[model samples]
Target: MKVFLAIAAKVRGTGVERAMAVARRSIGAAFPVPAEEVTHEEWREPGAALLAWTNEPGPAITYAAGVSGYLADPRDLPAAAAGDLGLGGCYSLFTCRSAATGPTGADPVYHAETPELHVYGSRALLVHLVATGGRVEHDPLALQSMVRQGYFLSDETPFAGVRALPPGHRITAGRAEPYGLAEPTDLASALVASVRGIEGTARLTLTGGRDSRLIAATLHAAGIPFTAVTYGTQDNPDVILARKVARRLRVDHQVIAPKPVTPDDTATRVAEVLRTCEGMTSAYENVAPHTPFRARPSLGGHGGEILRGGFLLGCQDHRRKLDALFLGNLDLLTAEAAEHARGLAESWQPTPETLDHLYLRYRVGRWHAAARAGIQRSGLRIQPFLDHRVVTAALAVDPAERATQGLVHGLIAELAPALARVPFEARRWPWSKPAQKTPDWRSEPGDALKSAILGSRELAAIVRLDRVEPLLYGPRLPKPALVWHLATVATLLRPMRMAVAA
Candidate 1:
């Protein structure tokens, strides 16, 4: 896995060193592969530096295409070339969009803003807190949001005094402007161009969904050879239809099976998934064993559905609908958390017509960002649908056309007619054998579920233990989904708690 931890400080000293050390240890311990520090350098600002480690060829950071120009070092960052930092091929995966450090707060703060997908900015929150010697504490509103929706809305995170940069916001200006991608004709053209821009062949995560199918069709039309990878059992419609789609295109297809785990490894695996997801998603939904992709650029269809109005289907009244959906479960919230929960809709700036665009920034930007980060641990990952040009074009299409998936259907027909021949798998057939599902901890023969929740003092403090404890032995059990959400949030907080305690 290729990863980096960079700090920008007012002056180079012991604090910066301590911050970097903590970040490296925190990141290294959570992932499957150990992150060895391979490249470290100090920049012009007395203490500013970028430290990187990788098993891959390039650094995770790259020069971003921004107001400056394509590939131009806008800020003239250090010209030093190390193992992967400056060797530059197309380092688009985690490109640095903008960076700035302080007018001094208690001490200097290090800010590195990258236009990367899936992570939003939680990965860098640790550095921000540690560099300033800031205390770490659970943010109640963030906890409430996580409990209700599995992830935060707007820029909320699970930590107080620390917030993720809002989606598509420029760090220096604090603006949420639409990301522009030069200009490509339509969705297909924009996707093809983006994929072509990657340094190597892209690995497509093919599924039965319309989003991935559109990507597959576009790649086939462009004559780009890409491997289609599916994750699920043979009985899974996604696996079945993905195979059909791959065969029609005559491209290589690979399926990764879902394996059931023993009770002994359940806790360990759950913690790893928690670290990967940043605790924004449930580990129960993703308990399958995952093998990292062979070091290659991976392409995902994230944010595509939003383009076709999949996220904004039924609600004409955006304000009323969004509030009803996100704002609830306030009984357990602290006063501050309750206030923050009430403010979510305002932060999103939702309106009836622009709801689709808002969902992109709200859901895709925040929740999808975490999922994308988890996948990147496998290798470099990119989402073509979120490409600025495609998003711009998709948003421009008539609402009626998008609602009926007119844009997506037409593009698939144009790109690869053969693909359109195979019907999209919206739902499995009534008689189709059920795909293998990951067993819940209760099903595992042991005290896995009880140990996980009861053992976490941090979790007990946030969630009422009395409510969760009795359900563990249940004649009636706690919802598996809720338990997963609780466990994940607790796992994320554990390391930070230990750091705070130390």
Candidate 2:
């Protein structure tokens, strides 16, 4: 397992060398693998290119977290061309306008960053790559899109010029193209086999949901030993159902409740998350259950929704699902900003499966903050849903079945009846919302956030600080949403240098 950092641009210079240092610091790869063992590729002709091992990669094929793909290939590290790249799995640093040159010739500028190319001019790029490798600074439109439609929603990143590589496309020397994939196999069996391929005992995250239960059934059928865990408030049905499933399977189970969050603790934690993850997307997973399984391979239900249409109720049109999705979430923006967010949504292609794939790419597979990144913090986080086997099988399913996740439910009901009997966590959504708490919005966290937003001379110029105060205060929405948005605004607006210096 290896995770490497790659930087390529039109002209070779000190910027590339400096990027290597940033990569090491960014990945926290303290020990170099000795110069001789390190892999290096430099292409001088087409605007120089450079690829170096950043901290050793964890696995040769790190599964794409929220999508059906892999980062590095089994055939080679730093895949040679677009065809070799995985579908919708890449983040490159380069400067190429329309029609990138053959292998890419010297462009006007040199850019560098990871997860995705950060092209918000020099300061924004430096803050994300060097200041805090996790989150990137956004321009006005980017900030508005995030505040309203959710972060990482449009191909538009917070930065200008830098674009996300759409699912199924690859970037090679700044050249990008889509590659067709071979068909996948039996997803249920594939889930088990994928875990077996990893040399170790596996731990599963059992939830009051079809995805986790489905995986548990498949793993049980294959005779793989695993420990199941559920964490959150005790009253959460997911905790109860997960326990019931674990008991039926005769597997060890643990239920952990969330720890109390102090204002200072939250600020620091949120700061770290906002900086590491692509957006303000984050949740505090109880560390207690994870402690016992820290060293073992853990499996999650990431990307399972690819088989289920997302919270897309009332969205009838193919091309305008993005608009529906934006509307589905709460409104925390000015009328102008909300409209701007809506405009960004309209840019979505009118494909039937557009939202499904976009959700996978932008929300899940984009970065580490969630289970994808949690694996980095915890043990090896493996999501069987992202396995090619599951992806292939899922695509073959009829769209209608996928919409209701009929396939997943059927699989569980047949293979794991006990799990099927339990009430689903989502079933209560219509009648029940999580108890929303009103926090002291004018207190420490709020003041800190206010200062952060106001301090960012760049972001404040466009984003009206007046509007930010109202949307972030009490009664606007749920506490969790309010907390996260504050973290997002603060993290994105505050420059890394200022954050650190303060």
Candidate 3:
């Protein structure tokens, strides 16, 4: 994984050097790699500086994270073409608006850009703030939104004054502008090109689903050499179907079954996930399945659901009705959070394309973007469906045609008719089945997570510990997912609160 911090201070006496030093210390604490592997660059006139560190070879380009690309110089930001970096991967990049101005560019996924400082690394931003002696206050609305909806609404983060850039938009001179994507003339060719852009080995997380199957077909059609890896027991439908797909394509197939983790390791995994994701999303899986993809770039089928119109499919075509459908579940939200969610819902224009665009912007851009950021900390993931060309093609498809995954099926058949012939798994809402025996929430908290949450004053301030005493002694726990979500929030706030208290 690569970690970096970029700062652009235009003022002459703003202590730019001191700021960079603090940033380096912060980033070092998180990465802890050899000093020689870190690359440092500076500019005098505009008072710009960048510190990029990677475990791999060559001078690191900290300008962008999560995507493989080249950066000629820090000053090229203002004139950077969108395609300068390859398509269909999660990333955060810093581009300058002009020779004399701060850096600006399109928001890839998890990035924060202020007037003078632009941070490309996810949790590195939080670490920098603590090291620089800046205030690290929590955003109540954002915290509530995370607990209620498993993600922050709009552009807000759990931390005050920090905003994750919405995908497909660019920030220049601290202002946002639309960087439009044109629909691809040839969708299959675009998919092929996107996969070919990856630098090293790539593996597809093959599953018994329309999205992954479509990607598998494209890889085979293009003659791309890649492995299809599945996680779960052999009896699982995903594994069973994935094996058939790989056999049809005649590609190497591997399956990694889930293994139990010791209690100590479970705690450690939870903490790592919280820090990596920077508390922008939930931390449901305490013991992530081990896999070979952690060290290699993995190809995933993210953002493909947009082509199928999978978000709020049956809801009425009205803004308020859509709001009620998506944002009305306020059982866990605070009063302020409910209001903010409603405001965001009402802000959308009720055009014919509202459903698809809304999902693309919020669900894929914000939620999935954060999730991918966390996953990339361990390994790189290339999402071909998220490429600008593919997104444009998806948006241009007729909604009625995609209502039942018609677009996905047609694309797969066009790419490889034999692979499309295999049946895939489909489930209704609330995907997970009930556990054989429900475990008590009080006993389920891992040691590290329990200690971190119980000792934090920051979490106590946001959540009322007295009201829900019977319900695991704190924060609303309607289900196991909510429990993990609250634990993630606590773990993320722990380090920031510790730094402040010290």
Query: How close is every model to the real structure, measured as TM-score?
Result: 0.74, 0.69, 0.78
| Model 3 regions lying over 4 Å from their true place | 29-45, 62-90, 96-135, 198-201, 261-269, 285-296, 313-334, 349-352, 426-457, 460-467, 473-478, 494-502
Q: Candidate 1 overall Cα lDDT vs. reference?
A: 0.53
What is each predicted model's overall lDDT from 0 to 1? 0.53, 0.47, 0.57
Candidate 2 matches the true fold with a TM-score of 0.69
Clashes of 2: 12
TM-score of 1: 0.74
Q: Candidate 1 residues 326-412, lDDT tens each?
A: 675554444565676777656555554556655665566556655555555455555566554466556667654686776788888
Each model's Cα RMSD: 7.1, 7.9, 5.7
| lDDT by residue (tens digit), candidate 3, 1-502 | 4554445554544555666666655554454334554555433335555455555444444233222222222333333433333234334454323111001111232344554454433343443463344545566666765665666656677666666555555554345555555444577777766566554456999888988898888777777778999987776778888999999988889999866543445455565655555566676743233232244657767667776774545655556656544474554444555676677666677654676666676677556655554454445556677665566656667765676777788889989988767887833225555433434443464445455555656556555544323334345344556556666776667645424222
Name the better of 1 and 2 by lDDT: 1
- Among the numbered candidates, top lDDT falls to 3
**Which is superior by TM-score, 1 or 3?**
3
Tell me the deviation in Å of residue 378 in model 2.
3.3
